[model samples]
Target: MSKPSYSKGLVGVIAGESAICTVGTGQGLNYRGYNVNDLAEHSTFEEVSHLLLYGHLPNKRQLEQYIRRLANFRQLSTAMRAVLEQLPGSSHPMDIMRTAASVMGSFEPEDENPNNEKQRNNQWECGDRLIAIFGPALLYWYQYHKNGTKIETRTGPNDTVAQNFVKLLLQTDNPDPNMVRAVDVSLILYAEHDFAASTFGAIVTTSTLSDVYSSVCTAIGTLRGPLHGGANEAAYRLISQFKTPDEAEQGLLKLLKEKKIVMGFGHRVYRKGDPRSPIVRDWARKLSEIINTPYAKNLYAVAERMEQVMMREKKMFTNLDFYASIVYHFCHIPTDFFTPVFVIARTSGWVSHIIEQRQDNKLMRPISIYTGPDPAKTPYVPIDKRLERSKL
Candidate 1:
């Protein structure tokens, strides 16, 4: 009866409402009304996860109890360990994360509750369990397949998520305090962004009344794409190719001339700039200074040169992933494991969105304006009479 309006990629579409985190809100990013700067400056990953899950920052006693609870949940079940052992080292780490989330769901199944009350509560616990165990699960697979070491998942009862992750990955009881803080701040910064691609994917799955694990698995799959969570890995690969800042400038200039799309340079929502970038960029610089190796120093320089070139050429600013790769590099993390780290941190946000979706249930179905052959002209033909279309 009337021409239907269409917005490609759903750009500028208000898909839903959320109060979880605000991006480009003039005062900078906030989680549950707390500024990201304050959270990054002062809060641990455990505290931020608590804020995302329980809707408030924890007091000292509450934080201690929460930490203990998460610690207690860190141990993987026998089946989980077996599954991790079977996964080959050739598998992508993000695939490992996806498989681990699905496997955890099987071992700890959520009962289907029509009322959703029991299921919702179970999801909260499931979220906490996954947050606690994801690092252990991932590193266990990594070490076992890499060199036949069945690494322990639990580093300490009191260790924060960042500490446990670093300790386990590095296989050291004593990790660099600066490295630990960098990881902690990265986790906080990456913990949530309102309706990001992966979060929205999780929300879409949740709208179908799926289990929390399935929803998180959906999120993981969505994040595995290069345009989303994989950007850091790609960005790191780009930075690693250059040995000097001047070389980096020339290489990046060539890339721009070739009309290549650089990863981790801009954002869809933050036209002004990504606030999260500078915070992690500072960490990258700090860690580079501490590492002081030629590679570390050179990588930081190359990254900075690339940032400057991107800004000068396209007026685009670096997003969180560009410099995050540098931070992870200084921490001795493998390039491929970069996005898996993203999964571990963003699990808190995924679970929060799942919980919120359950609170306000909807099918999330949107109509599309179809463009096809007219039904009257292209009536259903009998199979015997159908003609094959010509190749383009």
Candidate 2:
């Protein structure tokens, strides 16, 4: 062989196929052939989730039933609640999600036989149940630790997923309608991305015919990495450090001059620009208007200045996380919970990929180029005979 080629990080490599989402076409993102911008503008998170999971946008009747089904599945079992209460308060929310997911699987597992259709239906139900209750599970733990009380997680049947999440997190039944809409849009935008690192990790797990919860847990752990799903929290911390756009501009410029890494400006895909950024930026602006606070307006201005500076200086574009930070902040969500929120939205994509992987399953093993010395040339030494050639 002349040489074995490898793409580090699998950059621009086609590791597998997916019918769920298309990314970086320079046109925009699409979930199951529908444009993400359209979905974000016109569809609820539940609807987009249905599209991703079941492979089509539901009609009025279907959507009504789908929303009802998701609402019905939103309650956590007593065992699950007990498990959440036992986790340490200092644990990262992502870890909480990973543990919660694994715990849920233990409570309700798929059928043991892989060849049975019941197993597939069980997996699908598990996917829905997890997505439906993730917010409740996370918020229950959050409130128990923060307030020393167990907050009721079920808001009402009338509440949407985004609305319920905001309500439960803030411990209020009533929230700003505009904020609710902004959150719904954000969830839709984050719902699916084709073969994102976490999604790929889920696919790998599912390819081994593992349970859906195991796949989701694997994706959660993968997303917990700073490089992957934690960018929004990092971006929020950066923008929140400034008092005004001028201070933000100066601080950003200083960091840029010092060649420090910025977390949320660029993306691995979407070289021209992230198509989702503009849509989310608009929502962020609308949220800023709705909140109409000095801090909200200042933060929005800071984010804009950062975007402009990064583009002008680095020729980089704002990714979804940049504007998402502003939207989540205006909604009063904690920065630490940002990545966990990502896991909530992205569970749809993860479970969808898991189902897809199992439909045409194959182990995701890839070959590596060997660089070590030949085994024959290396002799194993017995513990008694081994001795150091030199002593320090």
Candidate 3:
């Protein structure tokens, strides 16, 4: 008999089909058939979230009602706030998001009946509720730790998620419109990608018929890895080490000589380039000009030089995280909070995947090729009879 072909890391494996997104073999990303670029240019994150979770983009009245629903979901319960308080002040913001989602499930558990329409609607509601609260919970925990003040999470009722996030982070009622728009665009860009590591994790959990919160928790844990969602934070640290474009080029060349892994230069998919990178790069440039601090101005130049060097040297392109770090810095977001913001944006897509998996539930159990000693040749050994590697 012929041995089946094996692909490491599941590369080129067709795990399953998803109607939620198109990536990896596309001109650009699409969420439910809407081009990501068009959504970034013309749609709010709320509208995009609605489009992803509820199928079609909401009409004006429908959008109004949806926003109102999200606004109501923003306030954290006393128990939820207490959980945040108990978490160490030094905890990573991603940890806070994970804990917040778990606590939310305890409060508003997913309905038990997967086959019922109301239960499905309940899952949808949970997704929205998560989107509404992630930023608030993160900011509330942030303010408490940074200032020793238990800040209010609820802001203006009409505020979009981006506006609410800025309001909470800056502790101001009126956030800069440009900053809000930048964040909104970033959220839209980050909202979904087909079968990303974290999204796949969510699907795997849901395939087992796990609850929505479990699936989201699984996704969050997967995204917390540095190679995955931490790229933006890593990219920022890399760029900030240099003061000028020339310095950046020299530094990068040296790092490349050492074979150091650049954090935000390439993608596993997207051979041409990340479509989202340039959009966020434009935002970074615009914000840099507006802010015009010495560091802010220098940052963009250094980043561009780095991009040029990478492409010229290695034929790699900048992914979204490279310029996104600059945009967040100009907006005054703390470096450590970068991945948490990713969690906030990505929760929409994670929940969507969870719901989609539940609709046609199947346990995800893939077989791995055996590489260890053959079972027939290596029978189970008694504890006292097993030889140590040194003896072997």
Candidate 4:
């Protein structure tokens, strides 16, 4: 056989085709051929979710109907709520998301027939339902643990996904409109990125013709790693440790001198810079200004200083997670809940990719070149023989 080409971490490997979202294209990221910038600036998170899931931006009547449909699905079944309530308080919020998705699957199992038209349509509805309810599920568990109360999941029918999340999370009837807008835009920015780790994980599960919920559960687990969706939380922790921009600059330099990896400063795909960074940075700046607290101001300053130091010393650019740290902070979202919010937005992308993968169904099985002892020649030694060999 010819020598097998190796790419560590599958870097630069084109594993499959997708039309859901495009990343690192020369013009920047696009979802369903709609530029990310346009979507973030002019659209709501609900609109973006609809665009991503349904394959086109909805007109006025369609959008209103879609929003109502999503709102209707936001309530969790009693059994699902019971599952969330019983999860240990010490559990990582991402784990709560994983368990919640999996449990929801049991309550509402997808049809097993991958080729069934009705089952396919049911998958799309399941995707939408997950996108709508994940926020409520997360907040229900969060409040149940923190406050020892079962807060209502259905805040209202008029709230957008972003608005509903903030309201449910903070237990407030009215949140700051700017804060709501900031969170919404962040959701829009995060709604999709082509073939990201979590999306790929979801795709791999779906390629086996698995249920959509199982695919999303796979995505949540994949995103829990520090190298992926957890980076924002890591970035926030790093930025919060310093009180001043100078201190942040000094701290970053020391870490770099020691050859430590910075959590949010690099990307696997975007060498020029993450196109989403500037947009989120703008929101971070706005939130800092609006809060106008010494701590908020300091955090934003520290983040900026870190970005400058990373670029100056290492020629590395900030990714979305870098500025997103500051944005989530100003929204008053807890540090631990950062990646769960990521899961909520990314559900749209993950489900869309899962559906796309099913359309061009292929089992994503790749062969690995063997480097160990020859399979035919290798013999299994008994425990006694292995022990004797070690002794000799």
The residue pairs that clash in candidate 2, if any, are none
lDDT of each: 0.90, 0.87, 0.90, 0.88
Q: What is the lDDT of residue 94 in candidate 1?
A: 89
TM-score: model 3 vs. ground truth: 0.96
Candidate 1 structure, TM-score to reference: 0.96
Q: Model 4 misses residue 95 by how many Å? A: 0.9
- Predicted candidate 3 versus true structure: per-residue lDDT over 1-392, tens digit per residue: 57778988888789888888988665579999988989999999999999999889999999999888898899989999999988999998889999999999998898787456224558888899999999999998989988999998888778899999999999999788999999999999999998999999998988877788999999999998888999999999999999999999999999999999998999988899999999999999999898877878888999999999999999999999999999998888999999989988998899888888776677899998766787788778899997777743
Tens digit of per-residue lDDT, candidate 1, span 195-236: 999999999998988899999999999999999999999998
Write candidate 2's Cα lDDT for 211-315 as tens digits.
888889889989988788999999899988988888988998899899998878888988888989999999999888877888778789989998988898899
Clashing pairs in 1: none
| Candidate 2: segments with Cα more than 4 A from true spot | 1-3, 116-119, 388-392
- After superposing candidate 1 on the true structure, give the runs of residues whose Cα lies further than 4 Å from its correct spot: 1-3, 117-119, 387-392
How close is each model in CA RMSD to the real structure? 1.7, 2.1, 1.9, 2.1
lDDT at position 191, candidate 3: 92
Off by over 4 Å in 4: 1-3, 114-119, 388-392
